[model samples]
Target: MKALPITVIRSIELLGLVLLITVLYVGSSIIMPVLLSFFISIMLLPVYRFFRKRKIPEIMSIILPILLLALFLAVLVWFFSSQISVLISEFDQIKKNVGMHLEKLSKWIESSFNYSATEQTKFINEQSNNILNSLGNILGGAMGSFSNFIIFFGLLPIYIFLMLFYKNLFLKFIFTWFRKEDHEKVKEGLKESEEIIKSYLLGLLIQITYMTILLGGLLLILGIKHALLIGVIFAILNLIPYIGALFGNIIGVLLTLSSSQELSSVFTVLIVIAIVQFLDNNILMPRIVGSKVKINAFAAIIGVVIGGSVAGISGMFLALPMIAVFKIIFDRTETLKHWGVLLADERPKDGENMI
Candidate 1:
């Protein structure tokens, strides 16, 4: 029998990828939670091991790590709640500031471009109504989905616990899919993936701490209000890679504009954020997270976009480590090694060897 033509093979491959993406998109609600639990369980493994070494019961060991996670989450929620209450109290003032800024902007536009305030008010009103309508629709949809969101988050700890409890069973389940000869390779890949997940989570925790201190401290020194809130918000959002950082910048600007009396303060905030991001991307993040993940920037950015498209915010946060795990598996399997190379950052030995 003749082999398939090159074009046919390429077309089939592309079709397969499209189908895979479609499946992921359709099943994201379930798949995303399970994937998140898997990673979280992996991150808790070291803690579980410590308990086991001290002669604790397996069930208790699992519960201990989960309890710690719960405590951490509680503190996070409390902090955010307090900060948000502070913001809510300032809402009236913020509204006044916004109106003043808008009036100033309208005047500038009228003088600079010969646009009348009447026309500006009409345009702004029209756009504002449209935006409000869109927001209403979005909020209504969110209310409908709120129960599912609660269920998703509520089930996460249970899922994590079950995953940790049945870790050995899952290991056995994995090996059952392959022959004895391939077991070692699969085992090695699993170990590497575990390390990658653990390191990535720890690195993120470190990133958040330093980023909040660096960004918030700088802004506070610069006499910016709500500096800590802005810092914390940006740090958390930055978990989503390139897209998150851009959103963080927008949030920073909006917050600065609302709180600051001078327009120069907005530019100052942006400059400071840019500097922090530079340090993060070049010096801090590379040493902390990048070294552990070993994924190229191109692959990371694509993964983030695809992940966001498939599963929104959760997908974006999970993308990098998930890709790294896939790369580990691909490299361990002989047939898929080239795919791993494509996902990696190392420069190819020769230009012509590019994937």
Candidate 2:
């Protein structure tokens, strides 16, 4: 039999890729949790191995890591909740400040547009009523989704445990997909992918810690209210790459405006955040995350957007590591190396990491 033409094969590959993406998007509710669990399991592998090394029981090894993860999340939630409660207690003040700002904004709009205050009030009332109607529907939808969130959270640990327990089975499943001669390459790809995932996740945790400290501490010193809350929110949002940092800036500015009487506080917050982001991007992130993932800015941004479209915020956070893993596998396979090249940044300079 004659072999297929290269163009035909390429076309087929593209078709398959599109189909796979469609399936993933359509089944994201099921797939996203599985993917999240896989990543979490991989991150916890080291802890699991450490316990296993000490001849600990397999169940204990699994439970320990999950317990630690739960404790960390609990503390984080408690801290943020406490800050949020403080903010909530100041809701009346925030509302007053917001009303004052809105009135000023309304006056400016009225002057510029020659719109009467009565007309503006009518428009505002109509819009507010529409928004309230939508809000009820949104709340109803949210209530439905809250159960899904509970299921996802509850299943995550169980999935992690199963994945860890059946690690050898997954390895066998991967190996069985390739020819015997290609097993070595597959093994190498798996190792590289695991290292990249572990490194990337750990680096993010470090980034969050330092960013919270630096941003929150700086804001506090600068006399910004809800400094820690702003820092924590920004740091978490910063996980989404370029788009996330922009949103973080917007959120920080809004928080500043709500709590601050001085307009200059907005500028101060923005400038401080810019400096902190610069230091992180230029100095801190490079040292921490390094070039282990090897993804370009364009690819990273595209990944975030695609991920967000497919799986919301969870997808955004998972996108980078997922792409990195794909790149690793693609680069290792000769037929797919071009795809890997497309995903990667320009080659790093000799002995230098390009993050």
Candidate 3:
């Protein structure tokens, strides 16, 4: 058969990409949990293997890891709930502080802009009403999605268990997809991908631990209220790459502002976050995570935005690892090697061209 023109082939590939994305977006509710479970299972693989090597029962091996995950999550929930209760108990103080800040802001606006205090109050009330309405709509939507939240979590363990239990079968199934001669390459890809996932996931856990300790510890020492809560929130948010850190900073500042009347606390929070983030980005992350998967910033950002668009926060969180896995697959496949290059962070040497 005559080969298709290069443009035709490229068009076909682009169309396939669109279709795949459409499918992912449309079926995200079903697909997100599976993807989450897959990653979780990969992270837990070593634990499962350790138990298996010790001659533990297969069922027990799986159950043990899931139990460990559950216990950790439960403890996290307990801690947050406790902290939140404390925050709630100080609600009166927070309300007063917020009112004071608003009054000061209103006065400043009136003086600087020649706006009357009455006009400022009226404008504030109008904006406040709009914000309240938006919040109400958001809360209603959240309540509607509460069942989905339950279902997602409820099915996660089952999916993980099944995936682990039938992992060998899945491996055989994957091997069957390629030619016998290509089996070695496929095996190498699988091994590399597994190492990448494990290393990336484990590195993230370490990052979270140190981030929480550093941020929370510093804030605590500085006499910041809800220091631990801010630390925990920022650490988890920082999982989403560049965007996560921004939101983490904003939340840290907001929490600090709400809890403390002093504006200096906001600056303190920002400065501490900046210093910690610098250390994390420059030193800690490089040492801990290394360059197991060297995705360029552009690709990482785009993947995160697309993932978040398709599947919300879960998508954003999973985007990097998913992209890493795809890069491995692409690099191993001759036709898709270009896609891998596109995702990679490597720069060309002088006189060296990618093509």
Candidate 4:
């Protein structure tokens, strides 16, 4: 075989990378529904196992969880719908307060920076339109998909049921398809991936609960109305990381301003969110997630951003778990463990050995 020129080699490498990314994008779109069903299955598996280990009938285990999950989802939908209705009913006041807040903010910026009021207003107007238009775009496609939305919704539960039933067989198939020498490694990888994903999901739920309690307590002390509503919304939103908390706080402050028009209230909400973020970043994540997922901070943030860019909210939520799964599988392979290690943040020091 003839040796390729350096330029040709570089071109080939770039082409390969581009092709790989394109395939990944296409594959994600094609397999996203199946993956989501599997994600739900993974979450329910532990509960199923907990019951099965006690000699509970497998059929009973499946029926119980599915029924409970359906009830929980119904309650969640009702709660969000009621809260959203309240907000929509108060939209007039909200619009007024928002406009007033913008005026105050523009003036404050001008006074602080010694800029012309006219220039500040112009800048604010330009920025606000861009923000609003972009928001409209984000929401534009959402409401128009009624038929498709119903179809997807109708399929989800059925998919979840089938996924739970077939999960073990799927795992066995994966192991059997691999070489005999790699069977143990593949099995271990699958187990680790399952544990990591389950832990991450549970950690997320725990964090949301913590944030709700913390934020709710603070808001109550600060005499904010609808404290529970705002706190819960922010807590759930905070799950998406950097942008999520920011979005949550922005909405919280807006609600506070509309309800009271008190700058101090807004400032307090901002501080509460900041403190919660600090604790979450430094404390909650490590203790809850346990680092076995093998995603580094930089990659985690970048993955979230890319996910948000591609699939919006769902993407942001799935990005880290997907990356963690990749890391887990990669780590199980001798040739790929180095790459997986690079993806991991925590490493043992001194004479410690990692399993």
Local distance difference test values of all predictions, in order? 0.90, 0.92, 0.94, 0.78
| Model 3, span 196-243: residue lDDT tens | 999999999999899999999999999999999999999999999899
- In order of appearance, the predictions have TM-scores of 0.94, 0.95, 0.97, 0.81
- C-alpha lDDT (0 to 100) for residue 292 of candidate 1: 72
Of candidates 4 and 2, the better by lDDT: 2
Which regions of candidate 2 fall more than 4 Å away from where they truly are? 347-355
On the 0 to 100 scale, the lDDT of residue 147 in model 1 is 83
Q: Model 3 Cα displacement at 288 (Å)?
A: 1.1
Write candidate 2's Cα lDDT for 194-255 as tens digits.
99999999899889999999999999998899999999999999988888999999999899
Residues 1-355, model 4: lDDT tens digits: 9998968865885697478556656665445556666777788888888888989988787766777778877986798798788879988887887788878887888789988889876887999999997887667677665655676667777888887777778877887789999787787888788998899888887887888888888888878867878888898888886778878988887778887676888788788778877888888877988765667788889889877766556678888898899787667766456657767887669788765
- 2 or 3, which is superior by lDDT? 3
TM-score-wise, the better of 1 and 4 is: 1
RMSD of each: 2.0, 3.4, 1.4, 4.7
* Cα-based lDDT at residue 150, candidate 1: 96
In model 3, state the lDDT of residue 205.
91
Q: Pick the candidate with the highest TM-score.
A: 3
- Residue pairs with backbone atoms closer than 3 Å in model 3 (clashes): none
Give residue 282's error in model 2 in angstroms: 0.9
Q: Which candidate is the best by lDDT?
A: 3
